[model samples]
Target chain A: MTAVADAGLDLRQIEQFLYREARYADEHDYDAWEALWTDDALYWVPAGDDAADPRSQVSVIYDNRNRIATRLKQLRTGKRYSQSPPSNLRRVISNVEILGTEGSDTVVGANFVLVESRTRGMEIWAGRVTYKLRVVDGEIRLAYKKVSLVNKDQPLPTLAFLI
Target chain B: MDCVTATVPQAGTDRPDYSALIQPERVHGSLYTDPRIFAEELERIWYRTWVYVGHESEVPQPGDYVRKNIGPQDLVMTRDREGQVHLLVNRCAHRANLVCEDERGNSNSFRCPYHGWTFRNNGELLGYPYHQGYGGRGKLNLGMATVPRVESYRGFVFGSFAEDGPTLTEHLGAAAGEIDRLCRLSPEGEVELNAGWLKHRTRANWKLLAENETDGYHPQFVHGSIFSVTGSPIGALYSEKSTAVTRDLGNGHSENDLRPEFRRHGEPMRWFGTTPDRVPDYVAKMRQAYGDEAEQILVEGAPHVMIFPNLFIAEIQVFVIQPLSVDECVQHSTAVQLKGAPELNRRMISQSIGSVGPAGMLLADDTEMYERNQVGAEQLRPEWLEIRRGMHRERVDERGLRVGTATDETGMRGFWSHYKTLMEDDK
Candidate 1:
């Protein structure tokens, strides 16, 4: 691990990649969203404020690559009742920063406010996201994505769509 | 503010008789919406019957306590010195302010924030800040009042506000077998609730959750995506006529029995998140503990048991439904872990989370349906919601319990019958 100067990384490009990822997920572009992740990706949304060990504490979403793939397949089938009429989602990702680098992976952090509209009503979902990004074949791919919801500690409503 | 104020129905309004609302084959929509009926239910059913408060494990040590609500009453379930469990009214004996507002904690005594009235963990009044001010003027018997009846069966504690009624065992009836089976699954013949729980609120009537727990028809539609993804045999097993059955276990308790052959062998497949690789090891451990009987204990499918009024033992999770209002309820789901099986417990926790919580694939759909059903029930056009799916096919078994096919409404009918009796009771 080495401390990298901000000037050394393409912040705009990274933000663009993050924005595209959010857009793909919002639009239910399953294949495109799936392609953005590495084969060994970890998608997680911890249940509480403090980061929790998924193996020990309960998590909202703690899926490995295989489980994520399975979930995508289910959503693609157009029969997932929770998301049959997919949530209308729009996210504003801000506070993007390059924390450092771990070997070939770049650590990035950002704050997100996602507005989701569904049958029941519209809800505002705010969260912090930490990503472990690795450049594979000159394209950035997500090795890990961790979401810490603002209201994670409280009893939550249905979160059918990906945050 | 007085917390123990009684809710008196408005005068001159004809209180709709529940007997007219709940027929054998159908129930009126007002059963899910009327505030007066809801208030009556709290008084008649919830207070009179044994409502589950908390598991003993939640307050295992002396001084440990958890706040619980039964109907409209707020209570604190505590384990005092000498290991006796007590359910005390949360309101202070003085001005009726809440003594303990936190969800749960360990405390020697509860000190009321307003007016400094204090009570011991066992609910004995310790003292007030300025007790001399009373000065033999007013007879202040300020000890916190315990619920009239509190009893525990196999570590599950229940309380009744009524002074007299059926014993906890008599009330549990055949449903006691469900709790026993859950306990016997553990090698130590004990289950613990040390792991954290998930709480979710649904915009639906509390009764809807009870009915949905044993409703076999909705899973195919509501949870189809989960089945499609996990490739679980639940979809097929539920559809097979000979495999799945819903039984009115009597006294309003009902169970949806899945995979009867496996259940008969005692190797029920109800363990959530059980992968093929984990099965051999888990089954081996069970064999090591219970010998040949382990096959039945370890491999049997978990039956979804709905104990009337509040508790639902859904295989890997214990769900308690709390009614907040006529059309709102909160569901608390605690993952069940076997006392000695760490690996199996881990799988159970994972599976419980997978199928429940806000992000759960199955529960999210069910919650949506509950809300939709509540909204639909508000419409006056369809005054009745039918519960006659398998009425013609229902039959009484040798045990005198009513039984029907998996997709039948036998369980709902049983529930409504008991509900009508309780609601119509003059006592």
Candidate 2:
């Protein structure tokens, strides 16, 4: 594990990157959001209250880079009925912290509360996010992003937009 | 209690008769609305018929249990110390308070939180705080009342509140063959619900789910987005006139057979032998397990089977509808995986989640349509909802089952026919 001092990555820059990533998702900026991921990026939203291995248990979203691209393409086509009109989303990212380093990747943790408004109603989605970020050409790229929703175990309404 | 024996509708009122509401070719919208009809259904249909409770694998050991509901009645499916599974009413025998509240757990006994009343997992009254309170009581029997009949077929447990109706086998009828086919797909001829379940609350009548399970007519239209996005060949396969068949599997059960070739698209293995790299080991394992029957058992698609009121075995997924009210229901969707095939089970779980999870590509569309149907049903102008899509074209098979084309409403007619008989039995 590399210490924060040894990694020499600016905390403010990392937070700014996180905020920008979230803003792009909230605005449904698919291209910009897709550009932020590494070629082998993993996007996971585990089912139930606790996270489990995606291979062993069911997950709300467990997409590899290719699957993520396919999902984005579906959304781009405007044919996904769940998000036909797209969700009006705004998120508050807080409690950002650097959780040391794994290999060449910098692990980051943060808390988020996303509000999604659609035709049915507005839903308050709160969850914790963990990101494995790697530096590509001096720019932060996401290697893995996992979202653990607070009400994952409960019956959830349609989550059409990206979390 | 007299509500059960009340006339279908008051003589002078404008309410439509129950008989006219459910006819051979059509059904009235009030069947999906009308609190009176809903209550009658809870008693006559849900209570009398075989309702799927839980799978045997859910309680793999003694003391394991899961709470389930039949219509509005709460019950617990528990395995007793003697290894016998029991479906007991969750209410405490002492004061009618619920005995078990947790969704699932392994517990030797359930002790009521309100009072100190304790009962064995099998629903037998173990002890109370003060047993001598009523001078040994007046015919005191505090055991949790078990549903009249509890039975299982091929590890699928079902319970009926009515004591003298059909046995589970008689109730399942032709549906039992579907269950057998599902179990036979497993290399070891067994399946488990261990891959966790996803529950979604739908703002639609419970029957909408039953109708949607095998209704091959709406997939192309309702799930148009999915078909366009995933490029699934299901739309084409279903549209290939004579290739697919919809049959009214006797005793209210119905099925839509989209042919074995339909499994080529989106399933683990395609018919053209282009297997994904991730599941090669799993495919090899299946081949080793089933030998020559691997292609048929592993690759041949399973028909969409709806077992009467509640259970739906949709290929790799098993969906159970728990009706909360006339307008509300909870769908418990579980992925069925082979007992001995771990990697293949993982692939199955992934596919199930991708298509049926709360945020799934397919189910999300279906949910929206179901809610829309409920909203549309509120308009009383259209009194009857038609189920006569292929009424004239329906052909009787050698076994006396009604068979129709893929996009036919023969399955819906079969369901309504059986439902009408049960609701009107009155005896």
Candidate 3:
């Protein structure tokens, strides 16, 4: 719970932002969740962990701003039967660390365990997430985010909803 | 010598009558849920037939190899010292422990983790830690067992356990033409599958996924949401009035050939709905190589065809279905990489990322339907799943191929009949 004096951001404020962002995703609030991203937003969930180059290898979900909007648009359609009946979702975020910064962006890392309940069954997903946050207009905006699942190397079930 | 022909069952042996279970217009539901039938299919079809291994491009240089499975068998496809590729059982000759553990790598010999026994990439017994223990080795000559027949067509490799059964070409039969059509897309007449596989697992029979791969009848209904949102012209290709037709390529191989519909538009790169201006270099190279046929190749695009028990060239991706058990199956797929056309490959990669895997806009919806379908198939009331759609309109073409409308059950009939032929052969 140490405050980050270098980036001029405290631990409480950053943790609050992360929790709110997660809550938006958990509630399927596509508009609010999507608005958190900057115009240069990069949302990635790399396949088989976050080591390989995305240009040569493949990914589960790799959206660079425009693709992110298209993904949200598809979810908003309601016709996305995979999420027609959204899964009941909840998550616990922990182990937040400030891993330094790049330019105005603050590089932060955290771990989470999400639970999704649906007609198929209850699914528990554990992953490590890295986020690059930048303050624009005195508000925190997500510049880059990547989720690395423990089982990213293995066969996965349908992940139609936002991670 | 005819692999397609059915062999008679010898007298006094207990053999299930597959004909009664697989009818002309419908199939019994028990075939999906029966554990006994699943076991039989492993022995009769998967293990004995020509199962797809991996593409040669995957193991381009000597010592490069990839791990794969043909049914329940554990295998390693290795490129040996002589630049020859061999499909070897991953077990060590001495202890039966796996020799190759990596999903893919470059190795000239694999040493067993359990014992010190080593094997050459070509399945030869190299040596062990102590040779004198079991009588000093003159030459054990008893290397790891190899798959009986390994063959390749246009760099696509396939392996067979049965040495006496159908040759790979004989098994491919009419399906080979579609493969040629796919390869001809490359200016060098080649396709590389270097992109790693994305696997999607479901609690359903493998046959169900195989049936749905080329099942044009269900896309409009199963994937309507995607069509509604994307408004892709490929959606129209699946409609009833579209010129595209389904073909029964025999030996259970079939296609929802959308060439005629794309050709009707007379547009270049219409498959991806992109113009020549966007991909001037790809179009230019393709034009220079094939001349007049380039237009047809551009429009025809990737094939939506399923090759018998395990393989599929599902438009932008290549799929291999692996049946885990009666109620479990996993599908492995990779985006098609058109060699020498970096521009086209890049687009296919991003387009495919959104289109098929577990999180795909298209496949995710279909997967939900498949899971729901599996739950329904478990119900006891309905003993049969009907395949009688468009039966009256289906007719045999001049080439003795059964042709039907885009949304017919003709492809399914082709699959099950050959399934019956294989299951009934008893030998």
For TM-score, the strongest prediction is: 3
Clashes of each: 8, 0, 0
Looking at candidate 2, what is the lDDT of residue B20?
Answer: 60
Q: Give per-model TM-scores.
A: 0.90, 0.90, 0.95
Candidate models: Cα lDDT each: 0.81, 0.81, 0.84
Across B110-148, the per-residue lDDT of candidate 3 in tens digits comes to: 888888788888888888877787688745777999998
Query: Across residues A30-125, which tens digit of lDDT does each residue of candidate 1 receive?
Result: 999999899999998877534555775677777889878877887887887778889999999999999999887889999999999987788899
Lowest lDDT block of 10, candidate 3 chain A: A1-10
Best by lDDT: 3
What is the per-residue lDDT of model 1 for residues B260-345, given as tens digits with 9 covering 90 to 100? 74565343444443543555665666668888777666566455899998999988888889888899887777678778778777
| Candidate 3 segments whose C-alpha is farther than 4 A from its true place | A1-7, B1-15
Considering only chain B, report the TM-score of model 2: 0.91
Query: Residue B248 in candidate 3 has what lDDT?
Result: 89
Candidate 1 DockQ, CA atoms: 0.55
Model 2 lDDT vs. the true structure?
0.81
Q: Rank the candidates by lDDT, best first.
A: 3, 1, 2
lDDT of 2 at B175: 83
1 or 2, greater by DockQ: 1
Per-residue alpha-carbon lDDT of candidate 2 for residues B1-427, written as tens digits (9 for 90 to 100): 1122222344355543667667777777778887778888888899889999889998999999988889778899999888899999989887899888787899989899999788888787877776688565334666999998999998999999988888888888888988887886666778888777787778889988899888988888877777787787667656745367889997789998755445434354552223636666656766788788776655554547999889999888899898888988888887887777676677778777777866777887788777778878767654668899988888998888899888899999999989888876868
